[model samples]
Target: MTNKLKAFIFPLALTLVSPVTLGETLRPEGLLSLRELPIEEGSADIQRLQITDRSGMVLVDTDKALPLIENEYSPNSYDGYTAKLLAERQTKITAIDLQGERYDLLSPSTRSGDYLLLITREEGNGAYNFNLRFRYDATAKSFDLNQVLLNENNSECDHSLLSTYSIDRKILGVISIANFDGRRVFGVLKELRLAHQTSGNMAEKLMPETVASNFDAALKAYKVGDAQALKTLVGYFLSGDEDGDCEPGNYIVEKYYFPQKVGWSNDLGFLFEQAGHYPEAVELLQHITRKHPDRVVAYLNLADAYWALGEREQARQAYGQYHEKMTAAQKQARIPPRVLERK
Candidate 1:
């Protein structure tokens, strides 16, 4: 893609108003309320539960023993509008042929500003399993039944019910849930921009050709091992305008734009490290570590990036984390034979 075209694709902050007249804009109306509904069914244990705002500010943190019930479906009885909305969601899941063994209410209903993320687990019949996101509207004080995100899997590998999530500004990054590729969790990052697009309401638009072309260009530069060219292009993408906005001079047609996958970000970060762009590499690598803590290699790469920048203490801390997490077998498999000799 031409530099001009690339400039038009990634904007720092997306405009709420779209030039291509589409669906009516959604405006939140009320203060979102959160309640911890008692879990009344199944053996699904509470692993970890916390709620935070867009800035990573902790709103609520709870590790109290969660109340769980049996496998048989027992619908929750509630008369309030919001409660009714949640009840309907539970009933719908019960009716579906998901080959579900049991259901678990992962956490009590929690709201972060205008959005409420409710998680329900459907224990699978062997490989087929999924978690449902009953996304509620805090403004309307009702669940938007239509915008539910189902994190489902049918693979043979056993999966965990818990998934890590992070919010960067207005975007919500849910790891391993929507973006897991059997082994590595790719990630499904969504911008919580309350706007409507032609595709549908609350739909995340994939990185388009206009944006992908730049990524492709970077890859092409990397394939031939042109470090300078790759760095230049990536720098362009990373560069901010006079206002320090990342996306500058771009008309944001899509209401929501998903970030590049964790794998993609890792690739770019390692490339940045190779090019001696330590700070840039650190930024990208840090994001992967935060969003995909399971990816051990990211920590190693981050340490290398820090070391390259003469940030010895930071590098030591990162390496310490990496060493602590890697098992003997895992370390043997991941670390090169030559590198292992030093240990």
Candidate 2:
């Protein structure tokens, strides 16, 4: 990418939108409601349930609804959506009391006309036992039980769920953690289908050439400070396979782009950092250090990101690594004054 392209992709501002106020009723015609019931007759355990919408339309009455589990741990794990709901506590759901029962309502910030209602019950050990999910379709104006996503984390095993949304395509890509044999692994969950593309259009394909062109376009948009266009292009590239097997854009970066350009991952990490996505930058930089340990500049970038996140010890470690790898001349000429001062 050129300096102009660099200018385009790097300095975009992030706007924070306050969440919509949610009172006793949900949005889109108050189409969802919650209820609480005892686990058994006279039992202290309670089940926060989804009975119907505010309009009294029954959604699902059965508690034994089969949930969608992560495919990797199938026969072992619950749904990937459940894992995501558990991991991203800040963005996914919020605790609210409805008619004396505590329920986890999907965060109002995520409201986009479509609604996802998650019902969960906490066990004595603090892990979730029962999980249910329901969806409200804005177009159809109907509420229905979508799927159960059950995930229970315990002392012997752990799970993580990561999800990224595509604004342009309205797709959600989920990565769920599962233990296979004795090792932990990540598996992609089923992804929403890609929006229809014009047939016979080579430009729409995920081929290397097409991806390269899109990358250029994204860089150009970034240079021009077209946040929407840049994000759309990035989302298009990051689009996951319909089969939920892989991310084509990430494949292109690892298989084609990185090999073609030395230190490309480092450059990308730096770009993410400059864009104020510190966590993303840190993740990318950490990956680069593990995959291409010889990329010395990545250590400095990683340190910068760690420092930005107020992780002083991690930042110090990264800076020390970078310092140890640099020659005296390089250190004097290229190292940032901040790194030297911190050291």
Of the candidates shown, which would achieve the greatest lDDT relative to the real structure? 2
Q: Which lDDT tens digits does candidate 2 get at residues 1-343?
A: 1111111122212111223545423234344433333232222211222345556776534322212222343333333211111111222432211111222333323334333334332222232222333344545554333333322222222211111111221121211111011011012111111112122111111113344566678678778998877667655533233445343223323322343244655666675565565766676688778867788888899999999999999999999888878864365577778887665
**Model 2, runs deviating above 4 Å:** 1-210, 217-262, 328-331
**For each candidate, what is the lDDT?**
0.40, 0.42
Best by TM-score: 1
Candidate 1 C-alpha lDDT tens digits along 307-338: 88888788878776777677633664666342
Count the clashes in each prediction: 6, 8
* TM-scores, each model vs. reference: 0.36, 0.32
Q: Which stretches of candidate 1 lie over 4 Å from their true place?
A: 1-205, 243-260, 336-343
